[model samples]
Target: MESSTQLVILAGLVIGLIYGAVGLLSGFCLMSSMRGWLAQGDGRLVRTYALAMAVAIAASQLLAGSGMADLGKSIYLQQSFSVPVLFLGGLLFGYGMVLSNGCGSRALVLLGRGNLRSFVVVIVLAIAAQMTLKGLIAPARIALVQASQITVNANSLPSLLAAFGAAEATSRALATSAIVVALILFAFAHPSFRRSPGQVAAGVIVGLLVTGGWFVTGFLGADEFNPVPVTSLTFVAPIADSLQYAMLSTGLTPNFGVATVAGVFAGSLITALATRRFQLEGYSSPRHMLRSAGGAALMGVGGVMAFGCSIGQGLTGLSTLALGSFVAVAGILLGTAAGLRGSLRVQPLAVA
Candidate 1:
């Protein structure tokens, strides 16, 4: 193994540990957060997510401004941004998360805690993601992406702001900082939320970890001769890739995504065990299993089409200031709202 690959993998594991720890500690699940806001009128969790995004955008943009990283090369910054596909993907992913009771990252955290239901979810999600990415659903996905994509000279938010008359440097700083400030204020505006130090810490730490993911892949792991793909944390393709690695270890080497995914499970397991929260769990009935499986399948397909999962687009992709990230996130939120209360709400699953 090359020294650089080893370093990347090690870095990925450390970052994953931090992210997973924060996630488990704070109950960091996008699906739950959104549902909390829309269905329960509880905004604390949503605020946590906002805090995470704010930290990610500010820190990531700073790295780019310092010339330490090139976020422009990320998949989120593609010249041709697909609108319809992202919307459809978000819708599917949002509703699926509701049905499964969690998002991809949340599922990983749960799996580490001995939740057999999460294990099933992880497996089904991976298989479904693989199908959408390169298997049975690939052709249709490609067609949808190709048909819905729009070519832009600059598809990123900062660039668009600059185009609208802000100076490039000012635009980047203003665009990024404004969102961060608003999120920070929103997160702390409530006295109740302000009192929850653990939740606050989780948001900040998770957000920084997004920046950390970018640094590991874009800066520390950069190799001009054998350049790794410029990316940060995301779970869609990585889940599928992780499953593939497990089955095809003899022929394949681990990448940042796979290592990070593996690390999430490991980190969560360690945390769960240490905290004495490691209890084995599974579905209560066949119907519960079926709903979860169906949800996992939708998430797999939707995540691929949207090009990211909640943390993938919500934080990692948004870190790049890409317009598509904004769009996809909006779609995800809309879909989540629907599933939580609007019209697509699934019945509650029985707890085992």
Candidate 2:
């Protein structure tokens, strides 16, 4: 069982590496998608992201319905829900992503393109996230979780459908189909989005990567003796966890999240180097540097509180159709809007 679990984890690493390479190569970024749609009136990026979310939901549901995996064991669909944490975390993460000029996946893409600022953002995000996850701030986080917990039996939409007397397979299939159709309709409705094959393909592939992470950890990492935490892609805490693992690897075993984070950075680096895009750059000003650092720290704290970042809870967790994930995603959208539309004077880079 242990060996089998190890194999599963190893397979997840490989899948993660593929995902990282594709994401970097294609410049996939949920943050940019959302921000662009809201701020610049260009909905293509957000539409692509939505399409990916739909694919992730449909594929994950199919996997679960076929008995290939069970998403209930994953952290996103935990029986206990916390609204304050989810909302607060989402707000922080959204603002942070905006201030840093990217999310985790975006950082990886930019790093590949020789952006030094993104490198600092990634490093700060990883460190601060680790600080919130299991380092100095963990005690406070635990206490908060204990205080705000709300218990429920069926945390996922599929399980809710199952409660309504639908057969397990039927419930999952119907739910998944509804979401996929909605997403497909939305994506195709926008002519601009429909024309971008790179964005479309990136969305679909990234969505699959989320589902692939679930399979790698939930099914593959399952073991009677040494079970792993159920999770998919999320940037905030995992970045921190990766940093922690680098320092404490002798005392801890590699988990899917940590491995995936490492794979994303390394895979992007390889792609960048191979394509001659790798370079080191930094913030244009002290104010910009401050924004990046503060954003990363807030993302670390908020991501842990909310249970995921945009990709983690928004795409990966939502794939399970979990109620908490939905709430978190909603909060993310709202928070992102606040940052983009509010009085803070958030501006896009020229990127020339």
Candidate 3:
């Protein structure tokens, strides 16, 4: 294997392990967070997410400031910002997260803990994602993006600022600093969040893991002969890639995303065993399974369209300060709110 490939695999494994371990330990579920905040008035998990976003934005911008990573080259920073697709996708994903009571990453962690239902979720999600990406639904997806996307000269916040006469470097710094400060204030505004060390740690570690992924792909894995796509953690495409790898190991080689996906599973399984959190679980009935399956399918398709899942768009994409990320996040929040409190809300199991 080439050195670049080896580095990518190694970095991906390290980051993935940390993500799994931290996620498992912290119970970091974005779906749960929103549900808790909306349904029960519990804000700890929501605050945790805010902290993670703040840290990711700050750390990622610092990495860019130091000239180590070119985040602008990432897919999220594309000039053709898709609006309608992202809005629709985010809506689907958020609603699905509520239905399934978890997102892709959460499903992985739950699977590690022996949730057979998550196995179904993973498979369905992967297949649905694959279909949207390159299989049956590709044509429609392509049409949607092509029709809805609007191209800008510069899609990043800093570049947009520069277009308004701000110096590029100054704009970048100011943007990063301002966003980080605002997020931190919001995250820490609640006294309960400041008191929860585990939640705080979860936010910090997960955010840094995202930055680490960027460094690996954009910096260490940067090769003149074969430059890796500048990317960080995202679950949609990676899950599909992992499924393809499982069936075509001889013809295909594992990349950072695949390795990261595998590592998360392994890391979470190991942690669950070591910490005595391992337990077997399954659906309450066929109806439950059907609901979960439907949710998974929506999530898979939506994630592909939006170019990310909750964590993918929420943290990794948002880290880019891309205008589209903001739009996507808003859609997700709106969809989640609808699911949690509106007519579309999916109720929990009635008697199980």
lDDT of 3 by residue, 138-228 (tens): 9999998888889889787888889989998899998888899998998999899999999999999999999999999999888989888
Off by over 4 Å in 2: 345-352
Q: Could you tell me the C-alpha RMSD of candidate 2 in Å?
A: 2.3
Candidate 2 CA-lDDT value? 0.79
Ranking by lDDT: 3, 1, 2
In terms of TM-score, how similar is model 2 to the real structure?
0.92
lDDT: worst 10-residue window of model 3: 343-352
Cα RMSD of all models vs. native, in order, equals: 1.0, 2.3, 1.1
Candidate 1 segments whose C-alpha is farther than 4 A from its true place? none
> Candidate 2 on 1-352: residue-level lDDT in tens?
3886667667666766777788776667777787678777888888888888998998888777777677877777778878777887888888888877778767866776678887788788887777777789889888877888899877877789999899977877887888889889999899988888988888888888888877777777677577777677777776777777888999877777777777777777788788887777767677788887888777778788888888888898889898898888777777777778878646654332
**Which stretches in model 3 have alpha-carbon errors above 4 Å?**
350-352
Question: What Cα-based lDDT does every candidate model obtain?
Answer: 0.89, 0.79, 0.90
Better of 1 and 3 by lDDT: 3
Clashing pairs in model 1?
none
Model 1 C-alpha lDDT per residue in residues 1-352, reported as the tens digit of each score: 6677788889988888877777787899999898788778888999999999999999999999998889988889988978989988988998898989999999999888889999999999999999998899999999888887899987887899888888988989988988889988999997778989888988888998899988888898788876777788898789899999999999998999998998899999999999999999988999999999999999999999888999999999898989888888888888787888855677676597
